[model samples]
Target chain A: MKYKVTESENISTVFLDGEIDMDVADNVREVVFPLIDSGKEVHLNLKGVQYMDSSGISVIVESNQRAKEKNTKVELKEVSQPVEKVLAMARKFL
Target chain B: MNTEATNLSEKKDFLVRSSSLKDVRSFSREVFEKFKIDENLREELVLAIAEAAQNIVKHAYKDYPDTQDRMAVRISCTDKELEIAFFDKGKPVEESKVKHRAIDDVKPGGLGTFFIQEIMDSIKFKEGDKPWINNLVLTKKL
Candidate 1:
């Protein structure tokens, strides 16, 4: 997956592209987690992401939980339809 | 999705590596398209299939990263249901050990199996006959 992190003031928006599976989960976490750890609110823009599997879903869940622990939040923004569907299904489990 | 179609079975083999996940998903999408699966459900099916494929790569073949093994995925659709089978020559899957973590537990890593269980109607793991070591079959009603 390809990603770009745009920082405006304190919020960091990570615009992720391509498909997210097991192969790219670590890379995704590497990109998104540190920003969350930075104590800044993070926004994961899924508009460019066309497909996401369980692994990708885990990244989001883990990020949110991490944010919770850090007293910050990782907000999902402009989630693509495909990702929204996956997230909806995953939410049933969460 | 009602009458069983006797005419739809397609299969493909890919290297048993994490990088092959996209190919696995692409193959699934193509087959689902030919089977005329609804566009909405097709992506869900693809996610299910890809998760199963990832299991084979991440769990079954976790020890053999450098080995040149190719796993096969077979998708068959009948009017009533769709069956997807995964064949891999890796560690034998212990049926009792194949459990997804409690969803409410909220964690990473184990969600792959959970997604598979959610998307498919039933899932079974069998001892692969001959050249294959593990056989995982997932079925979903159309």
Candidate 2:
């Protein structure tokens, strides 16, 4: 998967594309954690994500957790149906 | 055990093993098509199977470090419902300790089982066996 980060004042928008699976789980952790740990508002755009798996869901959930630790807000936008299902399922646990 | 009967029993035992996560979807699609399962139901079933299979590759055998034993996933579907079981000789998951950590709280793991249970009708885990098996069964009305 490919991810691009754009910073706008207080919010950081991360654009993600391609499939998010076990192979790319670490990449997500490396990219999103530091930003959340820095206490900046984060928005994840999943419009371009073609596919997702459980690992992908874990990454997003973990990112949200890190953001909470720093009092930063995180939101998800333009999530695809498949990606949405995974996210919705994750929401149930929350 | 008679020689003839043992050979017959061996032949009757069927196993379909796959290591590819992508195949999880493909396998689900094939089973749905072969059984004339509903289209909407097919998508749901695929999602459940994909999540379960991906969990095997991600958590069960995650400690390998070197992807040597990439993990194996086996699926069997019948007219009533679909059965998918993941076999990994990795560290056994402690059921009592296993809790669906809140997504909002965000820890790095623990969502796989929750997702599987959410999408599928039922889920069961067994680690008493030496190989450590996580078997999940999903059912949809015909």
Clashing pairs in 2: none
The collision pairs in model 1 are: B3-B79, B4-B79, B5-B79
Q: Taking the candidates in order, what DockQ does each have? A: 0.67, 0.33
Q: Candidate 1: list runs displaced more than 4 Å.
A: B1-5, B103-108
Tens digits of per-residue lDDT, candidate 2, A1-94, equal 7999999998889999887766677888888888888889989999999777667877876776778778987898899887887677666676
Question: Which lDDT value does model 2 have at B28?
Answer: 60
Candidate 1 lDDT, A1-94, residue by residue in tens = 8999999998999999999888899999998889988999999999999998888888888898999999999999999999998888788878
Interface RMSDs of all predictions?
Answer: 1.8, 3.2
Candidates in order, TM-scores: namely: 0.93, 0.70
State each model's C-alpha RMSD to the native. Answer: 2.0, 7.4
lDDT against true structure, model 2: 0.64
